[model samples]
Target: MLLALDAMGGDRAPQEPCRGAVRACESLPDLEVALVGDGKRLEPLLAEVSSNVRSRLHVVHTEEYITMEDSPSVSMRRKRNSSLRLALDMVRGKEAAGCVSAGNTGAIVAGGVLVLGRIAGIDRPGLGVPILSLSRTSLLIDVGATVRCKPVNLVQFALMGSIYMRCLAGVPEPSVALLSNGEEDIKGDDVISEAREILKASSLNFVGYVEGKDVPVGKTDVVVCDGYTGNVLLKFGEGLGEGVFGLMKEEIRRSFLPKIGLAFMWPMLRQLHTRFDYEKQGGTPLLGVEGTVIKAHGRSKARAIDNALRVARQFVLQRGVETIREEVAKGGM
Candidate 1:
């Protein structure tokens, strides 16, 4: 399968993305990547790759690119030939199966809606990220796609999140819950309360309200919330994990006994670290868009880029978009 990649999107840009494309091509035999960026910069980086891998890495040069600080609407309107825009264009034109970018989240969402259009019955596209919980990896939707959402939007997010977990994550029947201040049915604002009722009435395996504490222990397979809440929770979890690890490292360095303890506990700690690492998780899918679009972290490097491409490949291979369309249609929304 051919995938379009924004080679100039991330903090490391060109170099890391180029290396990642080569690595992805090497690992996935049937996969090909069209690196959309300045060909001059990207071509040199591919020189060391084997001929087989090099052959699969195609470069579609574009001088323009959207910056992290650029306004989403302004970027969409102005940067017509940017690497980000071109990559999405490839997907819209069917030149590539999907697109992956570690660029501006706002720009990607804006461009995805404007260029690729929304799937039938999807009011707005919700971004879903798979976060590692104690028992399982839970999918959190609307991590920054739509800040203000209606009751119907949350319900639609739950549907899409459930479909994503079932199809891509291989969950048999994903349990769904709304992220709220409390677990009581009466908790949350008007939107969440109304959404909870609607979800309970639907055919989904709705688990009612889930407090913020419930998310880390795998209380539900899918957690739904407005983008504002979801984004704050996602960032806080990331920061907390890093702060905890940093403290542990500092404590280990301060005393000899802790150093010896670290030697004994290194394997388990490393495993836990990997579980929470964003690099390993790669990109999050922008669900409800017309095509498969994986949004990698803006600070992503080579390994993260490689995994993000793999994610896009899996979404296409699993026929995720088609399944979502079918499921949403069945809901009569």
Candidate 2:
């Protein structure tokens, strides 16, 4: 299957994205990539890949690029030859199975809806951020995809999240939860309460309320919330994870015995740290769209971009786009 990549869209631009594309071509034999960007800059990096990989690599040149700071509409209105626009066009045209980008998250998302269009019956698409935790990796939907959402939007988010976790992450009967301030049903505002009722009555394995603290605990596979609350909770969780590790490092260095103790438990600590490293998940999948679009941070590295392509590959073979669309057609919305 063809995977379209935005080579000139990230902070590191062609180098990091091209390096990652090269990695995917070399390691994943079943996949071919279309490097959408300036061919002159990408040719050298493509040469570094093995001959077998080089054969699988394809280049689609475009003079324009969607800059990180450029408004999403600017690309839509003016930059017709932009790599980002053309890469999306390939997906809409069915020339590629899916698309992956570590650059221009907003533009990629906007282009997904505008270019490829959303799956019919879907109210709004969600940014499916896979939350890697100690016990298991769960998904947080609407994590900055839509700043505001109706109660029905949260319900669809729960449905899409559960389907993603079960199919891609290999979790069955994945527990679903409504992200809220308290475990009690009456804690949040009307939207949360309405979503709770909708989810609880549904066929999913709804496990009731999941507070912010329950996210890293890995108690549920899906946590649905409006984009605003989800973003705040996500950032807060990331800060907490960093803060805990920082405090532990300081304490470990404070005394001789502590340092020795940390050294003894270093492997375990390292494993725990790697579990929630954030980049390990690589990128967030923009779910509910007809085509797949994985959005990575603007400051992504080669390894992260590599993982993102791996994700797109999995999405294609898993037939997640078809599955989610079918599920939605069954009155999921």
Candidate 3:
């Protein structure tokens, strides 16, 4: 399978994505990566890769790129030749099975809709991010993709999230829940209430209501909410993960015994820390789009980008796009 990559997407630019493409090619022999960026800059990095892996690398040069500061709508309108846009175009044109970008989230979402287009039954695409909970991972949909959503939109998000968890994350009979202020069905606003009723009536494994605290407790496999709430929850979870480690470090430095204790449990601590690391997941998928589009973190390193490509490849292999279309159609609006 061929996957197009925005080599100039992240903070590290061509270097990280280029290195990632090389690593992915080395690991997956059947995969080819199209690095879209300025040829002059990417050529040297491409050369650094081993000859066998380098053979799988193809450069699709683009003089322009969308910066993190660029507005999604404006960038989509003006920067037609941007590396991100070109990478997405490859997916749209069927030159590549999928695309990966660590660029501006807005631009990536905009490009997915404008370039790759949305599924026939989808209202707007939602970003599905997997959040690590105590027992298992939960799929959080609309994590900053569409901030304001209608009841029907949340219904679609739930369906997409369920499909994603089942197909990609290997969760059978994934339970879906609406994110709310309380676990009670009577506790949410009109949108959540409407969505809850719809989901309860559908064939999905609807688990009623779930609160913010329930997320990390693994109360449900899929949590459906508007992008506004989803984004806040996701960021809060990320911050909490970092803050906990920071607190541990500060406490360890405060006392000699704590430091010594940490040394004894270093391996276990490291393993726990790895679970909270966002880079390990690499990126989140823009679900409901016609093609497989992964939006990696803006500060993604080579390892993160490599994993992002792996996500795209896995999505393609599972036929995620077609599966969503079929499922969404079956569920209806």
Candidate 4:
């Protein structure tokens, strides 16, 4: 399978994307990557790739590119030949199975909708991020795709999120929960209140509301919410994960005894760090887009880009889009 990658989309640019593509090719025997960016910039990085895996890497030239600060709507219209749009265009044209970008979230969503369009029954696409937990990861949908959504939109998000968790994560009957201030059914605002009724009547494993504190505990496999709230939660988790680790490091450096203790605890601490690492989570999928689209973090490096390709590959292999369409049709909402 061929995958389109925006080589110039992240903080590390062509270097990370190129190296990651090589790593992905090595890991997935059937995978090939199209690195979309300026050929001149990407050529040097490709040299660093091992000869055995080098044949799987190809570059698609494009000088035009979108910035992190560019308005998504404007950028979509203005930068037609941008690497991000071109990569997605490959998917639309069936030249690639999927596209991955570590760029601006809004720009990726805009380009995806404009280029690939949305699935027939999908009202709006949602950005679904996987949040790692003690037992398993939870899918947090609508992280930033649609800041303002209808009750029906939440229903669609729930259905799409559930399909993703089940198909990709192997959750046969994934539990779904609405993010709320309290566990009570009546806790959230009018949108959540109305959506709760619809989800309850649907065929999903509809668990009731889950508070912010309950999200990380992995009580539910899917956490559905408006984009405004979901994005805040996503950012909060990122900050908290890094902050806690930083505090631990500071304490470990305070004294010789604590430093010795750190050596004894290094293995467990490394495991915790790996669990909290955003790179390992890869990218968030923009569900409801006609083609597979992954929104990788802007700061992603080689490993993150590699994992994002893994995600795109799995999305295609598991038939995530088709599964969502089928589930939403049966959801009867």
In terms of TM-score, the best-performing candidate is 1
Q: What C-alpha lDDT do the candidate models reach, one value each? A: 0.90, 0.83, 0.88, 0.87
Candidate 2 lDDT, tens digit per residue, 67-97? 8788876676578788988888898899988
Candidate with better TM-score, 2 vs 4:
4
> Which digits, one per residue and each the tens of the lDDT, describe model 3 over residues 244-273?
999989998888898888888999988877
- Angstrom error at residue 290, model 1: 1.1
lDDT value, candidate 1, whole model? 0.90
Worst 10 residues of 4 by lDDT: 324-333
Candidate 4 lDDT, 1-333, residue by residue in tens: 999999989888878878888888998889999999999998988876777678888889999999889999899989999999999999999999999999878889888889989887888899988878888888888899888789989988998888888876888889999998999876999999899999999888999899988788888999999989988877887788889988887987776788888889999988887787654469888999889999888888788899999999988988887777776667533
Q: Which candidate is the best by lDDT?
A: 1
TM-score of each: 0.96, 0.90, 0.95, 0.95
Q: Which pairs in model 4 have colliding backbones?
A: none
* Candidate 4's TM-score: 0.95
Prediction 4 global C-alpha lDDT: 0.87
Off by over 4 Å in 3: none
Candidate 1 residues lying further than 4 Å off, grouped into runs, are none
